[model samples]
Target: MQIFRQKHLEAVYRRAAEMGPDVARSVELQMLITPKAMGIFKPGIEVIAPVLSTSRKEAKEAVRFIDDSPIRHLASITTPLIPMRTSHMSLVANVTHFPPDVRWCTDNIWIDAPVNNVLPGLKHIADTMPPAPNHSLRLNWQPAASRPDMAFSLESNNYLAVYGAWTRPKYDHKYENWAT
Candidate 1:
């Protein structure tokens, strides 16, 4: 899988580190797959996972799980599926107290396909395999920052609901919906 550190965001990380131990401790190592890698070219389907939260060892285990799963194969029927890649190593701030509470996120793997085509496979995987080791690593299915919609978190059992929400039409926002 392709992996790259976002050199541009390094200053944010460094600033958080300088905020003392509390703020530093709040930083989490996250992994996000690109929309293109997931075969999603649309605006609303990006997904993100906080895979490497606590340590590098945990990150390796999470990476191995993703690499071996059917998740990497959720592309179109005609096109060959692309392998999962590390979009970036995001320093996500878990606490709101921090000034730059950066939340690095993306779309669902099956965003390009119809919900009917995608949900069954995800449901089967969720049923047969164990829940994500760390419950916190669940997928965040959300629209792009430009859209006016609420972001939903998908737990192991709630995969159906998350997929169902995607079928809804986008709505106009009265206020700014700014969780990117």
Candidate 2:
């Protein structure tokens, strides 16, 4: 019977890998394997109570300080077995007693996040100009974190942002795109 249970769990794991994390997480919630006896979700919840408390806060202040934290010291080691961080933090090692790689993509994969991945930016311009003779506009753009050229570019022939009066014809304007 135990062997059959383990096989079922293995099948669930395979389903999680192929179907996605949400489906995998919901796999056979009725039956949970434990040493004491086959129990329900409530006992499992008690096994890692501290992790459940972290949901009270908005920012994840509890997670970063969870390991060796004065309040939830034991929870850091108990988190991995609970399957809470399996979606994103599975590969990111810190307090959990797990490997760098959890062997599956647990979270949404960004195709254009890598340095070599070239994702073309999209920009749009209004067809009809707003009826204003002064041609004044307000811009509320902040400094770019990584690519200044992408956020505030001087070249208009090809760009990821809409070209306005500020960057009209020859890039000559009262203020530079970078606010120089």
Winning model by lDDT: 1
- Tens-digit per-residue lDDT, 14-122, candidate 2: 3222322122111221112221111221111111212333343522333333233333332212343233454554343122222332221111112222212212111
Deviation in Å, model 2, residue 128 alpha carbon:
71
Candidate 1, superposed: residue stretches over 4 Å from native? 1-40, 75-156, 159-180
Question: Among these predicted structures, which one has the highest TM-score?
Answer: 1
User: What's the C-alpha lDDT at position 5 in model 1?
Assistant: 24
What TM-score would each prediction reach against the true structure? 0.25, 0.16
Which residue window of length 10 is worst by lDDT in model 1? 158-167
- Number of clashes in model 1? 7
True-structure lDDT of candidate 1? 0.27
The residue pairs found clashing in candidate 1 are 45-107, 46-106, 46-107, 46-108, 47-106, 47-107, 47-108
TM-score of 1: 0.25
Q: Would you give me the overall lDDT of model 2?
A: 0.23
